[model samples]
Target: MRGSPAGASFSAAAYLADVFKLKLADLHEGLVEADIKEWLVAEGDEVGEFEDLCFVMTDKASTEISSPVDGKVLKIYHPEGSTAKVGEVLVDIETDGPVAGSEAEAAPAAEPESAPEPAAAAAPAGGAGGEYDEQMITNAAGKSRRVPATPAVRGLARKHKIDLSQVAGNGKDGRVLKGDILKFIESGGAEGGLAPAAPQAPAGGAARAPAAVVPGESRTEKVAPVTKAMIRVMEEANAIPHFGYSDEITLNSLIETRLRLKPVAEAQGIKLTMMPLFIKAASMALTEYPILNSSLSGDKSEITYHGSHNICVAMDTPDGLTVPSIKSVEQLSILDIAAELNRLQELGAAGRLSRGDLEGGTFSLSNVGNIGGTYLSPVIIPGQVAIGAIGALRTLPRFDAEGNVIPAKVINVSWSGDHRIIDGATMARFSNVWKNYLENPDTMILNLK
Candidate 1:
């Protein structure tokens, strides 16, 4: 086979092998399929090991796959923009490098490890930690539990109001991925195992025909990818049972403190804003009210109190609205948070935010105050539980110590929490604590980490 010089392994001892089949690597592990955005190397082009040979795009992100061996691109199995399954033979190369053990390039090994029989329980993968552990949350029943699911799965459960714990995981490592919950729903299990929902007819008990568009009345345009992403998430977030609480914090002290520090911060190349203060206040509040800093699991039995205060800052960009996070806010100073917030904004503007930047948030701030929103009820970012919006700062009349009317700076703020774990009273109390840190900057200043 090696002497054939046609589609044979390169390990011909003395003779150079003619070809090597390039199988797709697990670059993005959770992703099942990706569209090849472009192929950087053409047939007959020489390529080196670790050189980016192609680009692939998934819904979450786009990744560049590199060549493993120096080679000449001989045949491209998949074209640009074509979908390819993971581990499939994406391309074939001609190289002097050693080739596979056999001629069947894409076929499995002769003695492939036998797969475990499908169990009632989910399959086990490597322990959920690092990336997988991002979704591994603790249940609220005082039990430390890790649900092996993806972010999309958790988002779906949130949308359908299904309890993941009730739905047995069948994915890798008992991972309760999106398909698991979907399968559970298909199996007549929602809240209770096998308790199905009765089918309901449309209003008026009639099947309606699809509505027709009037001629010359409307024009249709393809949905932009960024907007499409926003649509999916906003629809899911709106579907959740939303309950909100409103509160206000006099911005006088916070404003003064920031104004005083602005010059000092500017000298250090930091354009400090009120956002860092709000983030800092929220982080402090989370320490006192851990529930507000948590995202609820699919099952009502648990609220995963996050160990880190990764607070997301929602920003409006020309592309769309993006909320990237500054991780571990509890450990950051107001200045450090401000720096990270600026860095994240730069990344968002440049369209360089990785999926990691857009996820793993324990809490978030919708700082509409920058754009003149007095108070807007922000929809929770899917997967995470709570979000708060800050209103624009305004001057209001207030009584001074001597009973004289005085102008004071204030901003209205509001909280929208998951009613399951965070109650109205809880929101109120948490808001008060959050406001205390802002109104009394000294409290935050004295306790600054």
Candidate 2:
């Protein structure tokens, strides 16, 4: 019943539940999503408190989620190979008794045999008063935060002009039940009683993203063969130790250089583009910072500094995301690189790339510029040391040394590197070199000749 008491009258011996959700492990701090590798325990399997239940794959790494109670798994909301947002329910463990020293308050004593069907793990889409009615919101920081409560509870809340997130939950796992909302309104809410948005931080650290509370819905989809392959590759890449850095670089000189060369290259029936320019500059920087063009062994015991700069460019194709590298970028001139890129892009668009086109990549570049993205954290392919995300190039007004406001073509580049070997300063130094060549292509042009 919507807005009903915590434990409504039901048959005795009803089994209560302790829900376990996929959350960010200590090792995975910035990750917001993960995929269910597989369910270790199948539905109907009995489990103990704090027991390993399933493996989840994240961009950061893979980890196992443990059960929080001693009970039989009553339901499995999410199946294998499905993506789940952080804080989404992974499993529901039904227990005859309360969890060992659980912090969650029991919804009064109910009929033990009347074991209510586990509350739908997620809010139904637009089902106001359905089995699982909840309203979802994405905060200013672009994160989906779900507020858990039934329709009537939410209506009562709106009538009193209350923000549900501010109200504390007294039901199972601190869920804000209808009664909790009424109690909050009865306590003179909004007058002096709204909880702040940002959760309190530790004694000496910056506040972390608020712990997600709502269990997100999990939908299953049949992936194509290419998508399956891509998923496997991406999951393998997820184990890499990733660290991100971003910088705004001016592209005025590069833009001018390209404008002059565009006609020269077009005369030969070749379409010169900015991507080849990025690859060229990145290759130059990789020559000096060889680690950026290197690969680590499976155990990370050794690093192989590749001499041939095979710069792979990530592209989205109808089949899936494909990365085709231009072989020996260091040996090719910018024009030659551009022609190769054009060939690969056409092949990608036509879905005709060969295995060779997708292999032997030492480094990667992702251009979100075409899509008008200012910056992105591009995923580094497994084995490669680094990948850079190219932002949209824009002419923004910037103040000069003389305090004169002048228009400057700027681009934001975001780099993610293997933190285990390439430290932040090293990545920053390499980025600075790459940015130098792009910002002043004349220096790179001298090397080309």
Candidate 3:
């Protein structure tokens, strides 16, 4: 059977008849690459159904493929450097009982080798053993054998020109692992018998050597590296016409209300903050203006409306930026949103967010204000109609109904919407509703239910 969508939970196929052998399934189609993140079970180790077998890189993100049946791994297909294409066998697994599935037909095994004549051995390389030895030497023992290492370990060795034979392998059966190579490199064991020497100032001169300069006639063009996610986001945003709306919200009442709820939240062992309030307000605003919660199809032929408010919270990870969704934000209370937000943030920062956490977002919220930005026009995430940016709250003087100026905590909210689905008037109306809810914290609490 084919693999399911990236986020959906999937199980392996059932057992088949005749105790057929199970093969390692390829997760993606490409050149076979070996950089297995985890081995579900070791050699002769038994694994249950739906167990995580291994994670492999697919020129994209690392993905985990699960075991299709309960079995023991018989053999690994590639010995680290070998690459395989999609649907190619990865490993051999031995099943206990009858194997499941119609794909259990036995394949023909290799023909038995015949004995070679003594005269053939005298003549250079005429026997079956001669051919096998030649092929093994060429394919396995040539230049590649000198670097019998895992992909990550080989990468480190090449980066520093380290000889694998010089580094001790701590992996199973003396195989070189990344950590072993790294430790060797760090301790200078792989430095070609030369102790790293410190550089001295230029001989007979107080100043350092002159800096190198490029030729004047040579023209150099600067190009920035863009990630896959960034490319998709920019392509969608530029291709789609966007309508933006900005509004300033008075945060004075909101701040006071949070302060009042703080003690109660603390007593209940929950933290009360502006984020939960903002999420609640945004959820309410989404209900009032459901059009803002919909996305435009690529052909502009249809608009897709989502029933649940899967709000994507923009988070910064060590790898890059990631937006993990808080499923059903509309159903969560202020305290519940706070707890979920904290949990998601923690998962996102640790780079432990699963595929489900990153998919199916109907709307996104980016709190750039946390980094000191007062306002920002965030790019619209692909497949999502709108993205809201929250700015830092600051004290600003504003006139009240009495026409008297007073200091208030003012926050900036910027919304970028797909013009194909949401018009300027509709976006402005949505922003107005958000502003109203945020300004009146009491209304936010009432509407949250």
Candidate 4:
């Protein structure tokens, strides 16, 4: 064999010591793949350990993905708007040596706070919690730093020529929230002769922009990720045979109970709503009829009876509809459930819910009453066997035991169940049990652990 000469073209790649394949790991349960929303870095860019490389949008939530090593990105396997599956390589990087960042970064973002009771354990990922703070990065120059802010906030800052670093952050972990930037600009906080933001017209007198209209004009648009996922889930849900059950229940006792508890909850900085009460009663009812909290496997050969009552509540958010579940509602007190509900609702409104908050739902409840719906045929989520929709409370005259007419507070309830798993009789019985808990708050209180 002849020795290879310098001009013979020995591959330089052979001399490269460490090439790291950054595979997409399991960020949360049931996360098969994530749509890459945007890439923060490009090929040949050097990334610091734990620096975010991209943001991914799953069916229920969006999260940032970080690099696990101090390395230079050799190639990006998935571009923005591409779907990458779990265990698939996301990027290839040339690293210096063994990196310790992978293990810590792969785990799901920890909840900011813990629930008081063990059952109401899942916490919401909201605001500028530690998760967003971790995304703050140092620039390539290693002198300037990137502040943690949403794209909208950054754009607003750019439009005003305001430096985000100079703005004070009041969000969790000192992340620069959009409101903070607005306040900074409004207070004339910009330095170095940057132009102030344009003044707004007086509140009630501001002129509205005229709506533009063009006959026979149309444009095509892609569905948003959240909306697309919801459509896909609904289509899959439509495959299951469904049956509806309806009833009207007196909510007078439940109303009184809430009125009594309102002051207590308010004193403790929690908003007392009927949702926590509904969730509590449903969880209690689930104990007697576990089938309602069960699911059928894909092949329909096996049934899974979940131990905990992970009840999901459908939320109508600014982006779209989201159903984030409250974990183990069975073990939580009404107050505890109220706290968890508050946490989830806030996060859901801001579109900051974690996958953990959205997964492991065994049953669902949708309160259309808040939005003025009288009744709804709520759809069952794919994995869950049943769902309930509640209508607005209305007062109606009913005959008393003495044959005298009396005004009663009532609400319409509609139930949708997987016909394959739940029969009409079982559904009726479950509804009665749940209704009993609400009609008599004392019963629910006595049964509470």
Largest TM-score belongs to which candidate? 4
Could you give candidate 2's per-residue lDDT for residues 1-449 as a string of tens digits? Answer: 11222322111122234443223232234545656765657889766443346655544223445443456787787788787664455556665644333223222222111111111101111212332223444445564334544333454455446677788866543445655664675578744432211111111122224335557865565554356557877798789878999999998889889999987666543566788899999999888899899998987699999989999887765445667788898888777777666556644543444445677899999886766688688888887989999888788999888999999989999999988889999999999999988888988888763
The candidates, ranked best first by lDDT, are 4, 2, 1, 3
Residue 163 lDDT (model 2) = 77
TM-score, every prediction? 0.60, 0.51, 0.57, 0.65
Between candidates 2 and 4, the one scoring higher on TM-score is 4
The root-mean-square deviation over C-alpha atoms between each candidate and the true structure, in angstroms, is: 19.9, 21.5, 19.3, 11.5
Distance (Å) between predicted and true CA of 16, model 3?
A: 16
Model 3 is weakest, by summed lDDT over 10 consecutive residues, at: 118-127
Going through the candidates in the order shown, the clash numbers are 8, 11, 8, 0
Report lDDT (Cα) of residue 163, candidate 4.
68
* lDDT by residue (tens digit), candidate 3, 262-354: 766555334455777887788888998887778777787988788888888877653356677777878776766665555455444433344
Q: What ranking of all candidate models by TM-score puts the best one first?
A: 4, 1, 3, 2
Most lDDT-accurate candidate: 4
lDDT for residue 423 in candidate 2, whole number 0-100: 97
TM-score between model 4 and native: 0.65
